[model samples]
Target: MTALGLLYPGHSAEDDYPRIEQLLGSDIRVDVVHTDIGEDAHRVDALKEMGSPERLAAGVEQLRLTGAESVVWACTSGSFVYGWEGAHDQVRALARTAGMPASSTSFAFVHAAAELGVRRVAVGATYPDDVADLFASFLGAGGVEVVSVRGSGVITAAEVGEWTEEDVLTLARQADTPTAEALLLPDTALHTAALIPTLEKELSKPVLTANQVTVWEALRLTDRRVNAPALGALFTREPIVQV
Candidate 1:
């Protein structure tokens, strides 16, 4: 089995990893280790602290015990709040600490978009508009165009985790645009593991969620792919050929 480690921040939506593991069958294993959350606010300072090297290192120690081949920081706002370059550095540090391939959900969205040949996307963010704007900018750095972004102005991960399936669908509908090739729900705190197929069907397009892309990113690092259509378009594709 290919084991993927997720260094999650706090209590929201970490359960999505296990749901993904079950969906992908026994060939893959997902292990989540919650890192220090410090303050659960979505502000830049709080997020930066959340993804700090010290906290990630601590989480890596736990993942090492799980025999995880790859590690991913499973928080979108926590990584993107560091901006594109800083996020790269963050994962680099994580890789060094884990002694494995490492990435973050922010980069996961970018890579997932490219995997599906989607250049333009609309964002359905649970962060405030200002924080969500940072995500758009980070995507821009990764060569994905943000056609539009709609933020829910939610302040904490706890609140986002409590959002129901209908709430997620509503956000997707609100963020989608005619010009966008796909829609992105960029909040790992939000529960979306069960809503991916529904969201894609309702929008009639690809809907990439934070947790979904996080698992995909871990698999990408391991050069593995699974046939799980229920996980939506990203998982339906074949393994990516890395040059």
Candidate 2:
């Protein structure tokens, strides 16, 4: 079995892994090491705060020892909130520590969309409106256009995690734009992995969730090119070479 390591904040992996497993089809072993975001609120800000390089690096190091071939920082807000350069630096730093490939959920979203040949995308997030724009800008830098954006304005990882499936589905519907080729629910705190199939069916376009791309990118770094039927159009599309 191919092993992939995911470094995420505290949440229920039992709920998240099934969606990923459905995509990789039981051949991939996903090892998730959750860090405590609730305890160290001082070191990181919610979607808007700069992620601590020291803490992030340490977390990647810990996840690396979990027998993972590659590692991914599975927090979208925590990664891209640092801006493009900062996000790149963080990934490089984590890769250096792990002595393996590393990526962030934020970068994964854009790369996944690009892989699908999507140019315009709508934004759906559980963050405040202003904070959501930070994500938009990050994606825009990667050659994707942001059409419309909607946010729930919620703060704190715990609160975001506690949101129901209905909350995310509603937000995704509201954020859809006519010009959008895809919709991005870009927050690792908000679990949209299981909802990707539903979202794509409703929108009739690819709906790239945070964890979806995070996992996809991490898997791409390995030799495993998984075809996940349950992951929606993002995974259903052909494999794309990273530019």
Candidate 3:
């Protein structure tokens, strides 16, 4: 079986492996190796604690040791808050560490949007307002037009994981803005893989969740094809362009 590994830290709110399994249904194996984000919690007091290359590299190496075909740094804020170069460097380090393809949730989201040829977006986040704005700027740098951004101001990744699909739908609906061609739920902790189709139908637009994009991009690196309806438009669309 093909294996895709995830290197996650702390108590993440948007871990979606279960939903991925439910959507893909045993076609692929998804494994996660966790690290303690609690100790580094203070690093992000002002959303500034996101760029820890040393810590991130360590996590990637650990996951790589498990023999994954591909690995991803499954955190949005953790990768983007460092700015463009920082995010790029982090991916490079991960790829080197794992001796395989690597990507982060932030990069995956941008790649997914590019694949859909979407420029304008509405960002639905579960971060504080400040962090949400940071993500907007990050997206802007990636050639995506940030139409609007809304956040739930929740802290602690574990809590973000506890949010239900109904909760996410409510947030997603509210985040939709007039000029947005796509709605982005940018939290890896939120279970977006399951609710993507419902959100797209309700909003009449593509809904991009962090985990959905990450998985799609990771699989793309390995030449894997996915045709799962539960993953929504991300899987239903054409394959992502190779970089």
Candidate 4:
């Protein structure tokens, strides 16, 4: 079995891993190690602290001991809070510490959008506007253009994690614009695995969610592929080769 390692922050999105593993079928297994985030007044600051090199490295050490083939920093805001270069450097640090290929949910969004040949995308995030803008900038640095971004202004991942399908569908509807070829919900705390097809059907375009892209990115790192129709267009399309 191919073991994909995940280093997540706090309690958010941990359950999504099992859902992803099930979608991947019986061939892949997801092994996860979580890191604690320090308390802070602002959500961005808390995410930054959770994704800080020191904390991430510690989690990487734990996942490395699990004999994982590839590691993913499975926090969207946590990874994107540093901007593009910082998010890149964060993955590099994890790879170095784990001695394996590493990626984060932030990069996953950029790459997943690229896979669908979506140059301009509308982004809906379950974060404060400032934090959402940082994520849009991170995608921009990766050469994907964010046509528009709508943030829910939700303070914490824990709060985002509690959002229902109705909440996500409403935000996604609000985020989609005329020029957008795709829609992005960039937050690992979001549970979008089961709702991807529904969102796409409603929006008449592809909807790339954080956990979906994260799993796809992990599969890409290991050169593995699966046909997950229920996951949406990104999973059904051709595998993306990172340039």
TM-score of each: 0.97, 0.90, 0.89, 0.95
Clash number for each model = 0, 0, 10, 0
* Weakest ten-residue segment in model 1 by summed lDDT: 234-243
- Report the C-alpha lDDT of model 1 over 128-216, residue by residue, as the tens digit: 99999999999999999999999999999999999998899899998999999999999999999999999989998989999999999
- What order do you get sorting by TM-score, best first? 1, 4, 2, 3
1-243: candidate 2 lDDT, tens digit per residue: 778888886673325765686668767878887765545231235433335566566577667677799988888888877889889988898888888988888889877887888889999887777778888998988888998888777766667777788988889889998899999988777777778888888898888887788888888879667777688887777856667
lDDT of 3: 0.79
Q: Give the TM-score of candidate 3.
A: 0.89
TM-score between model 1 and native: 0.97
Q: What is the C-alpha RMSD of each candidate to the true structure, in Å?
A: 1.5, 2.6, 2.6, 1.8
Best by lDDT: 1
List, residue by residue over 126-223, the lDDT tens digit for candidate 4.
78888889888888899989999998888777787788989989999999998999999988778788899899999999999988888888888999
Better of 2 and 4 by lDDT: 4
Q: What is the clash tally of candidate 4?
A: 0
Worst 10 residues of 3 by lDDT: 39-48
By lDDT: ranked, best first: 1, 4, 3, 2
User: What are the lDDT scores of the predictions, listed in order?
Assistant: 0.92, 0.78, 0.79, 0.85
